[model samples]
Target chain A: MVMMNKEDFKTILKKDKKIIDRAFEEKFKDDNPLNEALRYATDSGKRIRPILFLESYKMLTKKSYLNDEIIEMALNIEMIHAYSLVHDDLPSMDNDDLRRGKPTVHKKFGEDIAILIGDSLLNLAFENSLNLAKNGQRFLDASLYLSKASGIDGMIKGQVYDLRRNLEIDLSYILEVYKNKTSRLFMAACVMAGLLNGLSEDKLKALENYAYYLGLSFQIQDDLLDKNEKNELNILSCKSLDEANSLLLDFNNKAKENINKFKNNDFHIYLIDYLTERTK
Target chain B: MVMMNKEDFKTILKKDKKIIDRAFEEKFKDDNPLNEALRYATDSGKRIRPILFLESYKMLTKKSYLNDEIIEMALNIEMIHAYSLVHDDLPSMDNDDLRRGKPTVHKKFGEDIAILIGDSLLNLAFENSLNLAKNGQRFLDASLYLSKASGIDGMIKGQVYDLRRNLEIDLSYILEVYKNKTSRLFMAACVMAGLLNGLSEDKLKALENYAYYLGLSFQIQDDLLDKNEKNELNILSCKSLDEANSLLLDFNNKAKENINKFKNNDFHIYLIDYLTERTK
Candidate 1:
């Protein structure tokens, strides 16, 4: 396996982020109030989902360059993420006044517009996918995988479980919330890599496993970092911080193990390292 | 064209309603809380959108039977409508406790679940569309049409506009709102019939025009009936009831004109007649 150094990793991340940024700019070319509000809502983010998506695409397809259709796929995932964040921050939900060091969409542009912004963003995600359907059945095939990951049995269900957080829940139930809330969308991005390029079944299963561990590790890290959360409180009360960190390390190690099973997996291995060590 | 008696029209409505009811039942066969909530929200509507969808499809294709793809297409429309109502009746939006003489989703399921219900329904609509994409590119083609008609520039924008309802707005502005909030989805359903069956440009254009007028007449009738809306209140204050009815007649006349342009038009004409004359 060819290894990617730190510079190679930065280059990949920067290029992927630029593609996603360009797609958003192009999709929002028309200046309307709804678009304006959507722009504000999606204005800032780490773009982690798109990064994972593009990297997975590259790793599976062995293609360094991405096409408009694939880029749009990445954008749709981010839009789904953006909209979920917007809704999750609403007064009736998490009541978060700030996100990513800026005021939440609801706080910036009234709650009503925020709701519409979230709704519009969700619709736009599908709009982008349907637009890509002109390319072939593969994009359409990938989109089914995507919508389920975002829907009732996936991310939204996780949000429901998260919102209805209970203090009495044990580690097992909290893990269920983490799987839905944090792991599913990430898993979709990773699995979409193989689904897009028609990766073999064994390799595809490996990617899915890779994504599962990646998501689990990421969520445990999130819980460890968050200063205020009912599950966080429950987590800390149930186990020691050191124990949580040990579990996270175990998941991270498992994520790396899946990556190592594939040929030409240097960059993917680098990605796992970056995510596991990511500060925020 | 075979001219139908009132009994035939009633007969068609009942049969179509039963098909839509079956589709929803089969779609929501899962007994999860989320599906249960979706079932409750989807139940008891007039099922107008799906009825129009099937009627339009039948008129264009001259087919008596609907495959699962077509039925799924119809279900997607009703899901959009159902979810929109669920969101609209939220405390943050319309705050209505009752809909169709039953407690609203939020009232019965709680606000967070209501929000998830709406989000999940939206995702399910796309999931169903993605599933139907396997039938052919036409379903994908129609899905692009469907998403745009539901997205930022369409129904959601209209909802934003409606939420910020201004009493000072004129009839022209109200018409714009009606076109976005009401006409686009109905127009999508109508135009999709031609898109799915690959109708000629002339026929498709007529379908669009037909839907435009259908939506206008329907919303105008809705406003004319509702005693609580600001625009309705404004209309009552500004003009005589007879003058408002005259405008309704003009739209209703325009709707019939478009339907008459089609060759196989008996039931389409009857559907329009029923919509305009129905007391409910």
Candidate 2:
């Protein structure tokens, strides 16, 4: 196994991001208003979700696995992420005009087109995943995991809790929000990789825990960096900056510990530190 | 074999609608804001898509099929339809306050919740469909067809064209919109049934054509009944009322002819007439 130097990890991440960007560009090159909005919505994110999926697959398969199907699955996760961001930035939602320092979908296109684009991206994710799923049961299982992680009981419920978080300020309630909203898709990323690689149940559970901790830590780090001032639910709302930082570290430590079960998990360990420590 | 009389056809339609409504109620019995919005949005719609799917399946298989899996598939299609309506009724879209004589999802709940509920319903559809897809290839194929038919190149594209219909008023453009927005899902309904029943490719094509014509005629009839006054695209805009009526008749007749190859297609033939002649 390659040593997990921070520089090497960054290089791998940059390379993976390029791969995902190229795949996304290829997927939505058609000329239409819908395609234009889709391209705009999916453009130029950090693509952490797909990279997380790719890294998890590498860790589990113990190979530099960059197959087309794997890339397609990663792209599907990214599409779901893009759709969420688009909807979250709608006029009745967060009402933001910018995403990733660029005009948000609703801002660039009209609100109507924004809504259609979000729906289109989500539908495209399923269309592509189902196409891959026709190959075998493993792909279908991976897709099913992705679906559940992003559905009513997962990400959508998190949005509902977030909208009503003012009514309840308890730590357990906040953590539940973070768990469902932020951590569910991340959990799906790792767990989908585990399912695709045919990992044992114990290893899969370990990956799930790893992803859970990693996702929570990542969200906390995001709040720490953004210093979000909105009324939306955030980890920094109740906890002081120092306490939130420590909580991030604790989750990161837990994430690193969970991946210790895998022999080739240097990238996993390095990723925990990389994500939680990143600025901006 | 039972002869398809008009009264018998109406009875079958009502029965099928009830079966679909019951399945929908069972699917969303979970108590939550998201589930509540889902139930409200799906409360009533005549259950046309699922009924079309069920009728197609019956026509092809020549069996009075009421299996749980088939009902689940039908529910999945209805969920997609319900999600579309919820999103379409948003303030930025159609801005409709009433749907099927009730307060729309956005009117009853907040727009943010409505958006989340739409996303949840769409996610739940794929989630359920993927679960069934694990059983075999037929289910997977059907789900894939549903996905493609409702995605960017299909229904979403139709919505996009609709939003920009003022930019172009050509007959071909409107027909394209009708084909993608309206016919695509209906095509998926019948073709999915064909796939599930393992019909031959030729027979599948016939079903696809039948659904296409039926869906177009249904939309024309909808425009006739609703007398849409919005600036949105409608066939009545380009053609006289009498011309639109004759066009509807032509489509219905074509739909009937396409399904003539099936020995048990009396119900399908009667459906074309019932849908086209309905006043409301």
Candidate 3:
């Protein structure tokens, strides 16, 4: 597998971050806590999902359009991701104080505002995606995809299962949780990018497979990093990186085959390598 | 003003409660805390919004179709309303333990589950609405109206404004908040019903004005109830009931004119009287 340096990845990620910042400014005009909560929640992240979306879109279309509509869509996705994180870190949930080396939304703006901000972000996501539809079927499709990913059939249900059940560490249950919580949205992102590019169903399916595996691998790496024996990261202790990595390897092999079916890009090869090799 | 006896109002409310109960059972299959949170949040309310919608529709069309789809749509609205109440009762928000004479959602099922349940309910509302859209364009318009009422430019943003500032009380600020927080959804409910009945635009506009004033009067009543000096329910001590009642009287007069434009129903007249005269 080819490896791409961290510098190149950072460059692309930075460009996406710039786009996200501009979009936030455009969509939220009121200088209130809603905007501040959004800014705080969004600015803390590494922009991983948006970067993946951009990369996958680039793979399919080989060109980027940083227009207002596209940027808004991208930001909307990022904001939803951030909002989920904020709610996840609430005192009643994971009870996390820090996210991505910063205070969580509830920590900074209080829980009421954080709750409203999260709710607002979710609503804004559909509002922004509706614009992408421009009075067409695509807008409807985008809204459907987003609603499904975040709805009971997807992330929220996954989280409910996580909270309700005792950790037996079953492979299937863990895999299902990961697929629903992490991979579903990631898959949607790639599918949406493919849709934007007007790619064939076959190609979109292939890209979805790629994203699914990439998400598994990425999550496993996170589990590994948080499981440092030297200094516990205080994440979930019931899961192991070895188990996670084994699952990732199985999925990654299938994803690589799909990615390979598309035109070979040096960046794609590097992404796969970086994702697979990352310790954190 | 025709004042309905308490027994009559209770009977109507009971019927409405049964409809909402059956809808809840059908929609939420899992009998876990997640489901319980939703049920607890929704089950005990007055069903004022759904009743308003159905009543408004009957006024315009003189035909009642209490089909599964209409019931589901009405339940969906209540669920959305319930979700907002759950979030609003969080410890970092209003921190209220009681709602409608029982434990609030967060109190009953920890804040995390409450938050997630609220999110789930909001998404399910859309899912339910989308199912109704299979009926026709009218359903789509209703869905859009629902979306607008609950979205950032509506209730959620208004909540944000309330949370962000400890402002000196002013009529304009109060009115703006009332419009966004309470009146918008109530107006949407009325308009949706009007759409269902194929009401003329002029009639719809008149109904909207009626609903808006009704909402304002209801909110003033609510604010006054919370300021019950004798009962010591000092949730908001900044304003007195006399002051709030003065505003309510003005709004009630305006709403009375709008209400007269529609052919009168005893229930409608009774509602206006009950809202105007009820004590905490």
Candidate 4:
């Protein structure tokens, strides 16, 4: 297997980011309040989720290029992510005014439009998924995987637990919050790649495990880096800084181990380190 | 054709409402905050959208009974409608303190949970739709139809129009808002029924027209009956009360005519009058 250096990883991610950004540009060209705010909310991100999806698919298919349907599916995942961030920033939620160095959706558009923007983005994600599914059964499975990950059994449940954080919190409860809120979508990204490519059930399960560990470690790293005191569900609340770091290291190791069975997995292995070891 | 009186209409509606309510009761049996608030948000809706879907399907299949998948799809439509109402009643949106003689979701369970509830319900709607679609191709088509009807091309766009109501509006603008916000879901209900039953494009077009006219008349009647003055896009703003009433009559007649071609459509025909002629 060919090993990829950090520069190669950056190059591939940049190319993938360009693909996602261009798709968003083309899809949201109309100048309306909904599209404007949608474009604004989705404008700039690391494209981490879509990149993970694309890399997973590439690892399996050995294809350097992807079809529009695959890219559209990845964009749908990003749209779900974008919508979550938009709603999370609402005054009644996280109540942040700034995101990505600009006013959030509710701050730029009115709260009504901001709420609709989030709802619209989520609906649009499924609309695109359904359209992609019309192509074949694999797409349908992928869409279902995504829908499950984002709904009550997954991300939404995580958000609910996070909101009720003050009620008899424990290490298990905080871990549950991280697993559902963060890891579910990560699992969706990877498992969707497996579903779309018709990977084996064994491989799909492995991908899910990889994503779960990756998500937990990445979230813990986020909490570690965040200077804000509002996150009562942070790992530090349950474990000391040293304990959190050791847990992060253990999770990062597990994440790499899960993907080691796949060929040409240097990028995936490096990704665990990159995501969980971010600088301030 | 079997001619039905108001008693039969009430009987069938009550039966269908029971089906929906029981499904909700079963689905939301968990006592967590999310399920509790979800049940509260969806508890007493009139089950209008789902009923429209079931009746349209019955019109095509001529079957007195439906399967669980079909019922689930119908429930999904209601879930989407319920989510819309929850979000619409948020403090940032319509700001209603009460709905159906009970506290709104945001009023009863804080604004944050209400937002998550709306997001969860919408996500849950598509999740159920995707699950139902796994039965066959027809269900997939039905799911796609519903998705488009609820997204930016449909309900969300209508909301944006409603939010931007003060922007140099006119009769056409108000009608645009009504068509998208009100009629789109009605169209989805009927069109999904047609799709699931493999109705010809001609019949689907007829169903679409029927739903459009029915929704317009329904909204006009609602505006006519509402004693509040907050609706800037109410038809009465441009038309006299007599003129608005005449227009409602015209749309109601059109609605009935579109569905008249189908045999055993008395229930559908009566639905228009039942919805438009609600007593204050």
Candidate 5:
């Protein structure tokens, strides 16, 4: 809880999560192990990534949600994010046995099925989006941005560094991890939504900046949550508690300022604050 | 090598393989583990799939190779095919130690890099194409077909069946595996090329049928080449050697007949015959 209408925010978040969940279930209705594994991995979550996309699109379009095309784009964003978690928790990757207070995908489904599940979800995102005949250039552009954001220059790069490199090098090194591993996809979600809405070039860049600062804070907060005591490689471990608190506030404020420049900042501003301020 | 004009067939196949190889090499130029693994997995192959696309495109447009856009599509096709191979050889999957007489990606690069390599390549394919601004609806339509052909109803489903289900059930089961596992991507390659050239509905169907029969033969012959001695679930062990040869000839003639319906199939007919007849 924060110094705000806590219950009101919770209600809004729950409603938004359901909407995205229904679309995901609809997108994948086939009765099979892969779908079973896919739906399982995607069943529970904050729906923050998809919500960010929806909120940005809403702000730009002045609509509560989106048309069919953009809605599908939002679904695909969540799907990719879920797949990353599935893969991240794999035995060869993070080797984690639990996530979201439950057995990881590998623990329940086996490593092989878990891997294929993640893979199928990734492909499913593309298949559903590319299969749509009406998205046009916006669709192409969004899909491209989504791929790059998750590929070598984006999420995967962050993951590679985390997995293969020494995380205890310095603060700058840790920041790179947060930026690539975390910020890139966040940036993609907001930026892609703006692209889908045909925002001006300046607005797109602004949206990206907004996601960047918010995402960095989001990653650091995650480190704080997961490792309260902190490791030498983590943001909290490198900085004192007071410093970390001020840093989070700085980023949260910067994110708010970035969106403030946009003409329609209602949903964007609300979502950014929600992402940075919410307690899990 | 098989009977008639072996040298001539070898020269042509080599030439076609070189064309696709150059495109793949050119598409991936970055210096990183991911890029290195991507290039390594794609370093050597017969290039039969991309050749099928090029031949079909040439047959439809009377263009020997392709323009920039179509070439990117072709490269993307090969990239997906290569990614499939890398994943298929994973420790949790087929666990293949060698491919094309060289160490597999997992064996050479370790499992983590190998897994990410496959994933990054998949994303790279879409990034290169969907990122292009000028591809239009034809590009979208072709991408849709590509996803379906390699996704649930296509290669992945076949792979799931292969992994979880018993392939030794019956010849019918084996055929389904061949159709989905091996043939769909081949069908996609040719049909997508035709789609790029804006071929008519009739011609597209014709191209699909031609590739289907040819691809079926190609898979059977591959099983025969790799396991002619009998591997229980393979083509040779499932049937008599005479039956296998008869099956190959039957599919070869049918593929030829399908293309015979097309007016300008000079390259198409030659390529299909080459794919079915060649031995290397």
Candidate 6:
């Protein structure tokens, strides 16, 4: 298995950036504040979630179905991701002025527009998912999966838990938050992509497990990064990269064991290496 | 046509309150700030939206399907309504301290919890809607209808428009806001009830028209009520309700004519009277 280098990932990111920009222009109308806010939020980000989705899908299938519709779907996921970030960055929440080295949506626009744009992106995600009529049932299932992951039962619930108490919650409680806040959507992405390509249920389930662990590892890595920053003003407490990397190794071992249940492929090995070893 | 007196409406409200309380208790397990915030936002509301849904359904169907599931459905709609109210009451928006004769959710539980609880209620609305499977397609359609109506393209979009600019918006703009903010969900309620009992498409459409007019009138009345309340701060410098009501009369006349297409049942007549003549 050939590992994907940083340059290759950067190339993918660059290509996706162009596609996302075009999708943003088409989906969001001219100068609409909601659209503008969404665009501003999406543009400033690293496009991590969509990249993870596409890369994982490509790893399993060994096919890159890059089209307008797929690009749009990916773009919509990014929009939802961006919307959550905007809402998370609100003055009442994290209250950050800068995100990804750009003015946050609420800072650039007003809070009102930021809220609406976040909302518009959420709805637009459904709208985008509904466009997958080539496989209607798959589309519906994917839409439902994404909706459940993004809604209160998932990310919102985690957010609610975070806000409701001040105690240092246990690892189990934190894992619940991580599952809802991070893992479920990633799982949805993998499962949906597999479903779209007519993967077997067993294979889809295996992919879901892999994605779930990947998500857990991703979040732990994020926590580690934030801890390294150690800014008192930072909303999230971060840990050192070494600590995060060690946890990632544990999570990666679990993911690798899960993935081994399926057919062996170079793509799968590449994915493991890319996700576990690569730094963004 | 005999009018539906306040007593009848109050009876329905009481029933709704009982169900809503039960559902609220079931959803929130912990008595943390988040649960309290959600309760603060939801409890003590008039339950007007759910009442409208049930009463309209009852009037059209002439059957008492006020089962636990139906009541739950009604409660779900109110939860969505309540969630929107909490978000609307945030310091970044209307920033109101008092709602329904008590301190608002943000005032009681802080802004972060208020936002999370609002998101939680929205998710719970969908979860609750899943329980309406006994009504089959009617319930599914109703839930979907409510979801779309409350979503960004519906009420949230109108709010976005309202907050974007402070200029004197035209009657068209105002109508857009009113239609999205009020009429769409009201229309969904009527349509949902009509569908529940297998009403004809023509009748459902007519009922929707009636609901649209009623919603417009309701908004006008609410604006007037707010304007008359000397203690409340004015959010907008809008035209008087008398002027708005005059325009609403045009729509109300059309609704009345549409109502005549249905059978001359006492319930239908009562609905028309209540909708057309009610000040609050």
DockQ of each: 0.76, 0.82, 0.41, 0.75, 0.56, 0.30
In model 2 chain A, the worst 10-residue window by lDDT is A163-172
Tens-place lDDT digits, model 2, residues B201-277: 99999999999999899888888887866766778778899998888888888898889988888778888887787
lDDT of 6 by residue, A118-200 (tens): 66666556445544433355555555666677776677776766555336655666677788777877787677667666788
- Model 5 quality (TM-score): 0.92
DockQ for model 2 equals 0.82
Off by over 4 Å in 5: A1-7, A166-168, A228-233, A263-267, A270-273, A277-280, B1-9, B228-232, B264-266, B270-273, B277-280
User: Model 1, range A17-110, lDDT digits (tens) per residue?
Assistant: 7777767776676866587778777766778888888888887777788887788898888999999999888887888899989999989888
lDDT score for candidate 6 against the true structure:
0.67
Largest lDDT belongs to which candidate?
4
Better of 1 and 2 by lDDT: 2
Q: Which ten residues in a row have the lowest lDDT in candidate 6 chain B?
A: B230-239
- A51-127: candidate 2 lDDT, tens digit per residue: 99999898777788588999999999999989999998998889999888988888888899888888888888888
Off by over 4 Å in 3: A1-11, A55-63, A66-68, A129-134, A194-205, A229-246, A264-269, A278-280, B1-16, B30-33, B129-141, B161-167, B195-202, B229-246, B264-267, B278-280
Across B16-129, the per-residue lDDT of candidate 6 in tens digits comes to 567667776676667443555565666676556777777776676567666777777777778777877888888888778988778888888888777667766765665456
Model number with the top DockQ: 2
lDDT of each: 0.81, 0.87, 0.71, 0.88, 0.78, 0.67
Q: Judged by DockQ cut-offs, is candidate 2 incorrect, acceptable, medium or high?
A: high
Interface residue Cα RMSD of candidate 5 after superposition: 2.0
Model 1 stretches astray by more than 4 angstroms: A166-168, A227-234, B166-168, B228-239
Interface Cα RMSD in Å, per prediction: 1.1, 1.0, 2.8, 1.4, 2.0, 4.3
Question: What's the distance in Å from true for residue A235, model 1?
Answer: 3.4
Error of 4 at A11 (Å): 1.0
